[model samples]
Target chain A: MNAPTSIKEFFESGYRQFLPHVSIDCAIFGFHDNQLKVLLLKMKNVEGWCLPGGFIQWAEPANEAAQRILQERTGISQVFLQQYYTFGEPERNKEPNLKDLIDSLNIEPAEDNWLFRRTISIGYYALVEFSKVTPTVDLLSDECCWWDMHELPKLLFDHDLMIGQALQTLRMQLNFHPVGYNLLPEKFTMPELQKLYETILDRPLDRRNFQKKMLSLRILERMDERKSVGPHKSPYYYRFDKNKYDQALQAGILLGF
Target chain B: MNAPTSIKEFFESGYRQFLPHVSIDCAIFGFHDNQLKVLLLKMKNVEGWCLPGGFIQWAEPANEAAQRILQERTGISQVFLQQYYTFGEPERNKEPNLKDLIDSLNIEPAEDNWLFRRTISIGYYALVEFSKVTPTVDLLSDECCWWDMHELPKLLFDHDLMIGQALQTLRMQLNFHPVGYNLLPEKFTMPELQKLYETILDRPLDRRNFQKKMLSLRILERMDERKSVGPHKSPYYYRFDKNKYDQALQAGILLGF
Candidate 1:
C-alpha cells in the first residue's frame, strides 16, 4: 500500500495502508543547559499541542513505526527509544466534537470512518541529544518544537496524561536503565550528569551522594579531562563505558540515588 | 455492546462490539512451592497452550479489559496487573494457516474477515495468588491450568514470546516494584520470600544478603510468628507493610538485588 498523498486521502483511505485503531505516540525527551524538554507538535487548525504520533503501517513493526514517526518529525533515528505504556481509554482520542474538529480541517468522512474509532496508542519515550534534532512537522501539524518539561502548554486529547505516564515510566526506568547515553554529551562533568537526573526526577539530590551512587554503578569511566571553572573547582569529565553500560542495562542492575 | 455469545458469532460480528485488530493477552504468574507458574489455556479444539487473552470491548478501557479477561479465566481479580509491552510485529499473530486453524475448530468466515487482519496485541502480566485462583475456560477454550514457568509446553500465537517478554519485564520491575505481595501468602517465612526472588530471577542469592537487602528497604515487617521447621531452623515470618509497600512502589525506589 502506498502512503496517503494528502490529509483527505489519509482520512478516507489510510486504513488500506495502516492498521486501524492503533497508533504510536512518542514523548521525545532531550537534556540541555540543566533543563529537561519534550518534543511537541501544534496540529494544523487545532489550538492545543500533542505528541508526534502516527498510525502503524500495515507491514511495519510497531517499534519501527515509532522510530519512523520520530525520524519524520525530528530527523533523528536510532536514539534510545523505550515503549513505556499503552494509552487505551475508550475516549482517549475523543474530542468534544471530532466532526467539528475535522470540519475545521476541511476533511469530511462517513460517521463510521476508521479515524473516528477508539484508538489505542502505544507510548514510547526517546532520549535524544538536544542539539541534533531538526524538528519537522507532519501534514497535520503546523509547528514542531521542544517545550520545557515543566512548562508545557495545554495538550490535545489525552496527551497531557500520556506525557505524565511517559515521564513516570522514564523516572522508574532510571532505577535500572543507565541514563545520559543519548541525552548527554560524550564527555560530561559529574555535575552535568547529576543535573540531568535531578531534572528528570524533579527533585534535588545531595551532590556527594549522587556522585557516589553513579560511580558505584561502575558504568561511568572517569576521564583525565576536566571542565575548568576556577583553578580549584574543576570537575573531571566522565563518559559511560558503552560496553559496561550496555551490560548493566542487560543485567538490569539497580542504580539508585 | 454485548459480547459475542458463540464462537461463530465472535468470528462473524465481533468487530462491532470489540476493537478490531487490537487485543489484550495476560501472562498470569503465580508462585507456589518455591516455583513460579503461569496460567495457560487450551483452546477448544487446539492442542497447544496459550495465555488468557480477549479483545477489548468498544466501551471498555484496555486495562479494565485485561482485568476482566483475567477474572474470567482464573476467577481472580484486582491482582497486581502491569501492562509491560505491546507486541506489534505485524506478523506476531500470523498463523501458517489461520483458516485451517479455524476450520479445525469448525468456524468459517470470509477471506478478508476482520479476524484475518493483522493484530497488535497489548501484553499485560498479572501476579495472582496461586491458591486463590479457580481456572475456568471461556467459550472457545476447553481447559485452563497453571504450568510451571520452567516447564511450559508449546504455546500458540506468539504466546511463548509474550511470556518471555513478560517475565523479563517482571524481573526488571523487581528493582522498583515490590513483588510477592500478590503471589505470596499474607505471612511467609524469610526463606520463602528469598525463594520467590530466586525463582523469578532464575538464580540463587546469598540468603543472608537477600534478607539484609530486603529488610533495608523498610517495606517488610517481621511478624511475631515463626514457621517451625526444626529446633535449630525456625525462621521468623515477615509480611509486607501494605502502606510502605504501596509508598515504595509510588516512589519508585530502587530495591536492588
Candidate 2:
C-alpha cells in the first residue's frame, strides 16, 4: 500500500469511523537461532520504531482487533494471541520526539486529529514460529522486521515499556502455560525446547531437571523421528500430544523453580 | 450518601468530566466464614447485582480509578489489586435487564449519556482481609454486601462472566504468587492457610503435600503464640516473614502442582 496522498485526504478517507482513542498494539514474539525476537515497525518518514498496531473499530471487540492487526502486519493468523496489558498513562501522547515526528509528517494539528490524540492502547502478544512470519509494511510504516530482544532500538510512545511488560508477562506464563510449543517447529527435540525456555527465562536450567519436569507433564509424545543439527548426535523428536496437552491445560499445570 | 434524586441532577452533578466509554470495575474478593466471597452492589430501583465500579478520570490511570472505586465502596485501601481482564464486547450494553434498568431510570436518551452508552471496562480483582472492610452503598446502589461465590445473585450486564474470569485468574495466580496472606490474619494456623487454599482452588488438597509445599518456600515464620478455636488441639500459628516474602516476590516463585 502506498503512503497517504495528503494529510487532509488521510483524515477524510482513513480510520475516521474507528474508535478515536483506542488502539491495539501487538508484540509478535518469535524464536530464531535460539534467540527471542520481537516484531517492530519502522515509521514512515521518521527515524523511530513502534509495534505493529491499528485502531479498533467502534463495533469490534478488542481481542478481535488484536488478531486482525496481527494478521494485517505479519501475515500470520490463528496464532496464540493474548491480551496482557493496557497502557493508558495521561502523558503517553506527549512524548517529545513523538510530537516532533507528527510535526515532521506535515499533518496539521486539529482537535479531530485522532492520530495525535491521547490513546489508551490494549497490548496483545503472540507467539509464532519464526519461519511462518512474512512481515509486510503498511501505508504508515516503511518496514516491518524482527529485532533481537537484547539489541532493540528506542521505540516510540512508551512502546519500550510495553515490550518490557509483555516480556515479563510471557515469562510468567511460561512457567504454567504450554507456550513454548508455539515458537518451535511442529516437531522438535528436547534440547531445542530447553533452549527456547532458557532464552525466554534468560537463565540456564539444569538439563536433567528440565527434562524430568517436562516429561512428567505427559504433554509431549515421543515421535519415531530424529534429526541431527550440526555435529551433535541425532536426538529423538517429539510433538505435543494435543489430547494430553489440552487436558493439562484444562486442569492446569504448575512447574516449580 | 443518598441516591440521586433525579436523573437530570445526577448527570449534572456526577462524573461528567471523566473519560467517556471507558471505566474500571473491581471484583473485590474476600475470604470469610471459611468460604470465598465477592463484594457486589445491588443496583437501586433495579433487580440486579453488579461489581463495584466507577468511571475513569480523563487525567487518571485506569489502575488508580479501580483503587479509588474499591476504596469508595469498601473502605479498604492499599490492598492487593490486579488488572486481570478487560471486557469489550460490542453488545455488552444490550443485556436485556441492563437495558431495561437504564430505560426505567427515566433519563433522557442522549448520545452523551455515559450510563447508557457502550463501555469497555477494565476488570480489576482485589484481595482484602474480610474483617477490615466496611461496605458502603453508593449513589447508584441501594445495598453493598459480600455474597458467597458459590451462590452469587444474577448480575447485570456481563458481570457474571467478568467474575468467573477473575476467579480463574486468581486461582492461576495462587500457584505461583504468595496471595493467601492477603486474605488471612497476621498470624494464621496451618489449617487456616490450607482452608484458604482449598477455598480458592475449590478442591481438597492432600494435607501433607500442601504442608510440605508451603513450608518448603521458607516464607513463613513460626509465631510464639497459639490459640485454640474449638475442640481441636492447638495448631501452631505462623506469620509471614516480610523480608523473606518480599525477596521471594522479587526473585519470583514457582510452586509446583
Candidate 3:
C-alpha cells in the first residue's frame, strides 16, 4: 500500500495501508552533560508533548516499524532499541472531547473512522549518542527535541507513564547489559563513567567502591595517563573493551551496584 | 458487546465485539516434580500444539484480558503474569492455503474477515502453582495440558520463538525479582529450593555457593525441623519471608548468579 499524501487521506483511508489498531512508540534516551534526557515531539494539532511514534505498516514487523520510526524522527539508524512494554488500556488514547478537537482542525472523519478507534501501542526504548542525534519532526508533528528526564512537561495521552516505565526498565537492564557503548565518547574518565551510572540510577555512589566494582567486571581497559598535567592532577582515561563487553552482554554478567 | 454464541457467529461478527488486529498469548510456566513446564493447547482441527491464547474484547484492558484468558484455560486466577514482548511480523500468523483449511471446517467467512487479517499479539508469561491448576480446553482447542520444557512438540505459528524469548526474560528476571513465592509449597528444604533454581537456569550450581547467596539475600526464613525423618537425615524447612521478598522486589536487589 502507498503512503497517504494528505491529512484527509490519512484519516479516511490509512487503515488500508497500516494496521488499524496497533501502533509503535519509542522512548529515545541520550546522555548529555551528565543529565539523562528523552526525546519528545509536539504534534501539528495536539496540545502537549509526546514520544516520537507512528503506525505500523501492513507488511512490516513491529521491530522494524519501531526502527523506521526512530530513524525518521532522530535521523539516526542502527540504534540500540529494545521493546520494553505494550500499553493497551482501553481508554489510553481517549481525549476529553476528541470529536470536537478534530472538528476544530477542520477535518471531518466518519463516526466509525479508524482514527477514533482504540489503539494498542508497542513501546520501545532506545539508547543513542546525544551529540550525534538530529531530531526532526514528522509529517504530523510540528517540533521535536529533547527534554530533561527530571524536568519533563505534562505529556499527552499516556506518554508520561510510558517514559516512567521505560526508564525503570533501562535502569534494571544496567545490572546485566553493558551500557555506555552508545551514550559515551570513545575515551572517557572514570569519574565520567561513574557519573553516567549515578545519573540513571538517581543515587550517589562511593568513589572507591564504584571503581572497584566496575573494574572487576572486566569490561573496561584503562589507557595511559595524559602527560599534560602534574602527576597528582592527572587521571587515567578508559574505553570499553568491545570484545569483552559483548561477551559479558551475551553471558549476562551481574553488576551489583 | 456480548460474547458470541457459536463458531458461526464468532467467524461472522466477532469483530464487532473485539479488537480486530490485536490478541494476547500466554506462556504459563509451572513447576512439577522438579521439572519446569509450559502449558500448551491443541486446536480442534489444527496439526500441532500452541500457547493458550485469545482475542481482546473492545473495552477490556490488555492485562485484564490476559488474566481472564489464563483463568479460562487453567481454572486458576490471579496468577503472576507479566507482559514480556509483542509479536507483529506480517506473516507470523499466516498459514499455507488458510482459505482451504477454513473451508474444511464448514464455516464460510468473508474475504476480508477480521480473523484472516494480520494480528499483533501481546506476549505474557505467567507463573502459577502447578498442583492447583486444572487444565481445561476452550472453544477452539481440543486439549490443554502441561508440556515439559525440554520435551515440547513442534508448535504452531511462531509460538516456539515466543516460548524461547519468554524463558529468557524469566531467567533475566531471576536476578532482581524474588521467585518461588507461588511455585513452591509453604514448607520446603534447601535442596528443593536449589533444585528449582537449577531447573530454571538450566545449569547445576555449586550447592554451598547457592546456599550462601540465597541466605545473604535475606528473603528466606528457616522453619522447625520435621520430626518424621531420622535426626541425621532431617533437613530444616524454609519458606519465603513475604515482607522481605516484596521489599527486595521493590528495591530491585541484584542476585549475582
Candidate achieving higher TM-score, 1 or 2: 1
DockQ of each: 0.88, 0.59, 0.88
The regions of model 2 sitting more than 4 angstroms off are: A1-16, A96-100, A103-105, A180-182, A228-232, A249-251, B1-16, B97-106, B229-232
Model 1, span A113-231: residue lDDT tens: 88888899999998889899999988787799999988999899999988999998888778777888877888989998888999999999999888888988899999989899896
Writing each residue's lDDT as its tens digit, candidate 2 over B81-177 gives: 9899888797786664344555667765555655655678788998888988999987677799999999999898889999999999988877777
By TM-score, is 1 or 3 better? 3
Model 1 chain B scores worst on lDDT over the 10 consecutive residues at: B92-101
TM-score of chain A of each: 0.95, 0.89, 0.93
Backbone clashes in model 2, listed as residue pairs? none
For model 1 the local lDDT of residue A218 reads: 96
Expressed as tens digits, the lDDT of each residue in A141-223 for candidate 2 is: 77899999999997888899999999999888777777666677789899999998999889999999999989999999999
Q: Which residue pairs does candidate 1 place in steric collision?
A: none
Q: What tens digits encode model 3's per-residue C-alpha lDDT throughout B170-215?
A: 9888877778888888888888889999999999989999899889
TM-score of 3: 0.95
Q: Give the alpha-carbon lDDT of every model.
A: 0.87, 0.81, 0.87
Runs of candidate 1 exceeding 4 Å displacement: A96-101
